[model samples]
Target: MIFFDRVSKVYPDGSVALQNVTLTIEPKEFVSIVGQSGAGKTTLLKMLLAEEIPTDGQVFFESSDVHDLGKNEMNELRRKIGMVFQDYRLISGKTVYENIAFTMEAAGKTDEEIEQDVPHVLELVDLSSKIWNFPKELSGGEKQRVAIARALVNQPDVLVADEPTGNLDPVNTYDIVQILKRINDIGTTVILTTHNKGIIDSLGKRVIVMEKGKIIRDDKQGKYFI
Candidate 1:
């Protein structure tokens, strides 16, 4: 579960990306964050991962305040939450297998565990066939699937995807969406931020709409009202 209490983000240049926002997301919920280009969606995601600190208010993950955590504690917190982006942030030099294994290694898992975990997640994303291939060789959809596998390999508590389908065609976008939904089916909290109206409308779940830095609507079984 996640909660934000009157959170706001103000940059040094006198701009605010989010203002006085408060929201809650329960466990195992699939939520979509919809907004225009200048909305605060990306800023909100950054705050959740402690990539940026709030100027006011708080961020809580499973009832624990992330800002209150120590260095070692933050590292541990990170293992429980995985993030994906539009770019598919895979290391160019590492093969698909190593890319997925890198996550477990950073979390300090042993080699035996890595050997067990990597194959299963790759299979989960249906990318087991391309395990030894590097990022340069995969298509956009394949890279995204690889990203999903990496995010889920550590058995994260939540998966935060920001514009996950930004670069793909309709078919590839649908493919990624199905994979995300499948991940949610197994109980991980899924937070998706996308501009694709068709995908958002089809989801028919909790949808939060933001504009000019404020959350204007939060609805269950929501429509794409933005």
Candidate 2:
């Protein structure tokens, strides 16, 4: 579903984040990228989501080269892609219900549709009871769950999470992973970047390791080999 051909990203100051990294992720598959900081993991995800243009090589979504898209076209592509960040980028002032609801509303979903869809997705993330709480009132895990619900409310075809479980305790981390797995089961392609050893060990899926801005290893049923 996603392809990178000889992708390399170098910052303006001559620092390399990704070096000629080539990889592919099939539809409905869960691919985890394991790497230490400065290994270009985020550079890979950002390129896929059009947040950054690769300094060299190409990034393709399905059949189209993303770098060739216009601003108008990229917006359409973003709607099909969902991103979860290490920080729960929630609007602290908004209630959990409004947090998820506003996403569909912003996309021009009707009031009725928002009301119907919001509750359904909240249940999916097991946040039904916490729907009325504000970000400050909820626990770390609860806040992250709210973020996940918001990401899925758009019914995105691909889910890209960058260090999603970084701030949570083990119990919360486990919960978040389970929710991600459930979403993946429903056929959304999942691309995750994490430094957590246990998750990479247990998942046993495809692992792409990047070092000094280059893909050094690519393996199926991959391990956390640095």
Best by TM-score: 1
lDDT of 1 by residue, 106-220 (tens): 9999999999989999888888999999999999999999999999999999999999999999999998999999999999999999999999989889999999999999999
Over 33-138, each residue of candidate 2 has an lDDT whose tens digit, in order, gives 8888988899899999889988899999998899999988888788788889999899988999988887887677999999899999999988899989899999
Candidate 2 TM-score to native:
0.96
Candidate 2 regions exceeding 4 Å error are none
Clashes found in each candidate (C-alpha, N, C closer than 3 A): 0, 3
Candidate 2 overall Cα lDDT vs. reference?
0.89
What's model 1's lDDT at 11?
93
**Winning candidate number (lDDT):** 1
* Pairs in clash, predicted candidate 1: none
In model 1, where do residues sit more than 4 Å from their true spots?
none
